[model samples]
Target: MNTFQFPMKMVKRQVYDRIAVQDQISKTELLQEMDITSSSLNRILDELVREGWISESGQGQSTGGRRPTLYRIDPTHRYILGLEISRVYSVLGLYDLQMNTIASYRWFMDEHMTPERLVDYVEERIDWMLNDYQLTWSQIIGIGIGAVGPLDREKGIILNPVYFPANGWKNVAICQMLNERTGLMAVLENGANTALIGEHWAVRDENMQHMLFVNVGAGIRSAMMSGGQLVRGAVDREGSIGQMIIQTDGERLHDQGNYGALEAFASVQALEQQVRQRMKLGMDIWEAAEDLRPEQVHFDTLITGLNQGNIFLQELFARSAGYMGIGLANIIHILLPEKVILGGALINANPSYYEQAIAVARKKVGYDDSYQPIFSKGVLQERAVAVGAAVMILQQMEL
Candidate 1:
């Protein structure tokens, strides 16, 4: 018989070149896109089908007669791993080729995230998760990590983050390290970008193009997406909005040499500091939030109090939402994103936060839909960063 020594790289390219254009396409259309003859394209499609990466999903509607078969990528043919590393904990997520989460692990880092220890811990967890799912290492597309910034994505090392207790993030090449340990390609990205990706994935409307995703937790940032891809600068530092000063006269900052930023005014630590100051004035938030569990101290109690008609807590959240609006208004005036999604711990606890934030923004930016983007809460909520991380891995692998 016959043996066609297929150039694997070209075949891979041809397969993805078709997949990259749309969710599905016809063999004739793909042949035109590839600038190849029908017979050659048919041969490539046959090879892809035999390899189980592409599938024939029946015929398209006939314009007159003789309908053509529609082909599409098999989403289950590959998978990607995503990791969201925070100060106190981490979450590992998995995504299939269609950019859907198959499974996840919410892990508490505790005191064990030391630079030396974290690598092995993460590796073990990845292996265990794959084993549990009965998936092989070869099926993994890649790994994507989203962590607190300012991160060195090129070096794959986390620098000094505001929340964690560390001398400084050491020379930790997380991607390279993970690749060495697990034998898979890995990529690293900022946590805010992951949040943006999560918001992007949740959009049901394809026409709404531009978006600014704000990750409002212990720190604040805005990740921008334009024309369906992240808008990174020439150096890739596009969305580090935490350092944009909103206050004229604020207190001194850490030894990091930054001051009077939105992070200072609106971070979780700032809210905690306010609570401590209120405590000095004999305002017992503990008694006010008496029904709250210890595990739910991270602003759920405040949200509860607000929901239960506690005027004091309502005022606090309202004020925070107001400040958030102030920041977002600035973003709207500049970027004019079609939508803005609010994520992180504090904001997601109450749906009212979006209302309050929009209320404040309306006063500042106005309510005209003609020039304004739709405002909404992040659909992925707290899992956004983790989910984005997983998706990032998949995207990098072009799965």
Candidate 2:
């Protein structure tokens, strides 16, 4: 791991990861679960303790012989920086080894912001946060960015992101640029993947090996975790659930020429367009959205109108929820995940949409009593992407 340059075998790393997740474990438990000799386990544990990654907590009651010494992960030994970039706003957080946010900041993202300007903004914020928290550069393990995609992860570049307001963003080497600017290791990942990672770690559900995370915003996307590992298909496009075809003769077609795609119906951009069209047809949309111009219609404005008893917006949102239900049902039937987590501003603003979508999805799934995946809102909500990005660094560190 970049944070710790200790030479260790794969088995030792695996044992260390287990202890990190479990909080505290005994040598007896490690011996039984790790399938390694006592001498080897002791040597690994000793090396980790000497390296300040693990520490003795207390004694554990033995099943038969002498008491066993318990070990716990040292949470303050290192830190990580997580950054989440979105069209409307961006967030930065500093996290310790135990995944605690020591400091955080959020700022608006102007449509005219450039890549160089963003890097400069981030560098300034990082310095301020470090100073406020009394931390040094040596304490920071690395930086992780949860960015909007499509991305070239291996090359650390953001490749033609959709809905990005700034120009000249094509193939921007975000990670490499940040690494050079801050002199720290950096990694880049899509919003969906990072959000899933954050939720998985936050829940800490050891039994939930199979789960699905859906992000509904300006666009729709999803990520899947199966058998305790992320499912990244060829080209890392395995979970583009938004592109799933729901109808053959669907009128809505995406830029990729796909008809009846999920995003075309359920995304915030689509909702805004639909609202604008209704306004142009002499509909009294302005009665509910009195101050908003037809061209200035946004998802939040629609939600406000819905709250003001606007029937048109109510129906429009319901229809959007139904479309989301169909898409989610298709995902459940194929993946059979243990749970489906929904996130993003659209879902958060109108909770009724999530309820209606789940009701419709349950009906479509039929009477399959063997496995029923739980549907719920993301626990981390808006912070999921940034926190997940930081957790990715910890995972890479094998903590």
User: Which candidate gets the maximum lDDT versus the true structure?
Assistant: 2
The per-model lDDT (C-alpha) reads: 0.71, 0.83
For candidate 2, give the lDDT.
0.83
**RMSD (Å) per prediction:** 4.4, 3.2
Candidate 1 per-residue lDDT, tens place, 1-399, comes to 123444544556566645644777887677666666777677778877888878888888887878989988888888888788766467887888766778877765554467556677777877787888899988988888888776788888766566564333555677777878888887888888987886687663465578888877766766888888888865544335766667767643332325666666666656655665565565567465455433345544555567787777777777777777888888788887878887766676677777887778767777565575777777787778887887776555532
Clashes found in each candidate (C-alpha, N, C closer than 3 A):
0, 0
In model 2, which range of ten residues has the least summed lDDT? 249-258
Q: What is the TM-score of each candidate against the true structure?
A: 0.83, 0.90
Tell me the spans in candidate 1 whose CA falls farther than 4 Å from its real position.
1-24, 29-36, 62-67, 108-111, 165-171, 201-208, 234-239, 251-259, 280-282, 288-309, 367-370
Any runs in candidate 2 off by more than 4 Å, and if so which? 1-7, 62-67, 247-249, 253-257
lDDT of 2 by residue, 1-399 (tens): 744445446777888888987878998888888778899889899999999989999988877988989999898888999999876568899999888888888876656677898999999989998889788998899998988888889899988866666776788999999999999999999888899999888888556798899988878878999987888877755237878888776646335536888888887877887877777876777475665677888766878888887787789889989999999999899999988899876788787888998888888886777778888787788899999999999888753
lDDT score at residue 32, model 1, on the 0-100 scale:
66
